[model samples]
Target: MEAPTVTALQTLKALVALQEIDVRIRDLEKDRQQIPARMKEIDKLLEEKHHELSEEKNQLAEVELARRMLESDLKAEKEKIKKWEARLNEIKSNRDYQALSREIEAARKANLGIEDEILRKMQDIEDLKTSVSQKEEDLNESEKSLLEERTELKKKLDSLNADIAKEESTRAESLGQIDRRWLAQYDSIRKRRDGVAVVPVLDEHCQGCYMGIPPQQYNTVLRGEQIVTCPFCHRILYYAKSLEEMSEDKA
Candidate 1:
């Protein structure tokens, strides 16, 4: 068997290194993609909570306004009763006195009805206050957690971006070491083969497609004298040193 040439072995090493860089870059980009979706989910939850609190406050405002208006009506009715009482003493005829008395009774009945309505309004106002307090508490708790989560997501996204940038620079340097024709071929193959351009041949099996390699192709790969591509997946085939081969080399 012919010994492997230095140039061929060096090309294989470069290709392997380039593949590692590409894989990591893809993973980091995927992590970066996930950050925004998670942050958006947190924001959506907070928005819903904010709306709930606002609605409760608005309800409280409406209840308070009703209570104030009712109080004003009560004051006006009391004043009317006082004026009617004074006018009763000034009446000279029995018929006039009786008519004034009836008018006063009607006014007092209306006042009683207004007082009952005021009491009901006060009860609603108290219930609304409790609801507003509970909603505010819930919002505060959610905001604290949302703030923490948003911060963490941003940090993760920044880290991923930094890592991806570093890897891209490294990949550019690695491209310079590889033959242009080989690099071009690798890129073309990766585009069609799920970003996997190079794979190991283990025990006559093509790792890319898990297909059995032909005996002639297997021999060429073991010799490492030429570049070989898998016929099935069209991925560049690499010959990995076996445990026995490594042991023998050490000895």
Candidate 2:
């Protein structure tokens, strides 16, 4: 095969360099997109923690309300027992006295049950208070840690965004090295083939699609006299062995 002219070789080199920038720019943009998603993931965790803290606080309030109600009921029952006992001297008959005694006994039993329940409720309130305190502490720590993480993530997102912008600026500059026709061609193929417009041929195989190129076409591609598009993938093919060295950043 005949050797490529100097100008064609230069064009090929520019194309390679442009492709390099495109690859980097794409990767940086991908990073740009993922950082926000990560932030949202952390935000979700923070929201769940806040919900847990609120639930514990509400539960404590409920337990306290129950304890107060139980106390009020127990006080009412004790007052009734005292008033009924004071009427014992006014009984008219033995039958009436026994009835009054039974009534006092029933009231005392009820008071005892209420007292036990009140004690149990008081203990429950204490346990609930402890739970609320512990939960508040945990929530505060989580908030602090999450805020720190968010700040760090924000920094990362800013850096990735800046890098993406830098790469995009470089891509625009690299476009100046090629003609409008070549740029349009590269853009078209890149859009259709997952941002890959150019590729190398190794062992007569188009690396883009891993399909074998016809021998004659492969030979012409090696000559590099003109831009060659692969038959299967329709991407520009390069032969690194004959032209300039391939970018070490390949892949």
Candidate 3:
């Protein structure tokens, strides 16, 4: 079998290398982008935790204020009871004593009610304190995990960036050796079609779109007369060796 011309072979090699580097770069960039997204997710979770904690603390404060107010009211009621008892000493009739006794009973009931409310508020405050402690613990743990994750991601991004720099240097060297017109054509097609300018023709089919090649076009590709394009996809085409052909070539 006839070998491809030196120019064609070089162009093929360069294109293949360019494709490799491009794929690596694209993959690395995707990974890099994921770092930010992961951090954003962590940030959102932390923000939600903070907001929940803030709301809980606010509720606790309100309950505490209510408890204090209830205590003050209880104290004032006790004071009123003392004054009523002193007035009972000066009661001049059974009617007056009965009226003072009724007033004392009402004050006692009101004080009991205030005490019950204060107890409920204290219970609520205790529950809130527990919740706040748990939330803070969770926040601390998450923050630690986030810091470690950020460090790891940063290391990976740095390594990928180094690889990209090396690959870029190699790609530039390879690109310089390709014919200007062919490079221009490749770039133009790649820009228009998702960075896939050249595609292999395999099994008498265009790999780009899996369209069958007519006998005439297949003959021209075999002849290597000129650069051929797939009619369906308009991508520059080259004949790729089959597995059998590859084995034979290797042998």
lDDT of each residue in 35-85, candidate 3, tens digit only: 778777877877888899899989989899988988988898899899999
66-128 per-residue lDDT for model 1 (tens digits): 989989999998999999899999999999999989999999999999999999989998998
Residues 142-246 of candidate 2: C-alpha lDDT, one tens digit per residue: 889888998998998889888888888888887767766777888999999999998989999999999999999999889877778899998988888656543
Worst 10 residues of 3 by lDDT: 1-10
Clashes found in each candidate (C-alpha, N, C closer than 3 A): 0, 0, 0
Tell how far residue 85 is off in model 1, in angstroms.
3.1
Regions of model 2 farther than 4 Å from truth: 1-6, 241-251
| lDDT leader | 1
TM-score of 1: 0.85
**Candidate 2 lDDT score relative to the true structure:** 0.83
How far off is residue 207 in model 2, in Å?
2.1
In TM-score terms, candidate 3 sits at 0.82
Worst 10 residues of 2 by lDDT: 1-10
Error of 2 at 73 (Å): 1.8
Superpose all Cα atoms of candidate 1 onto the true structure and report the RMSD in Å to 1 decimal: 4.0
* TM-scores of all predicted structures: 0.85, 0.86, 0.82
Ranking by lDDT: 1, 2, 3
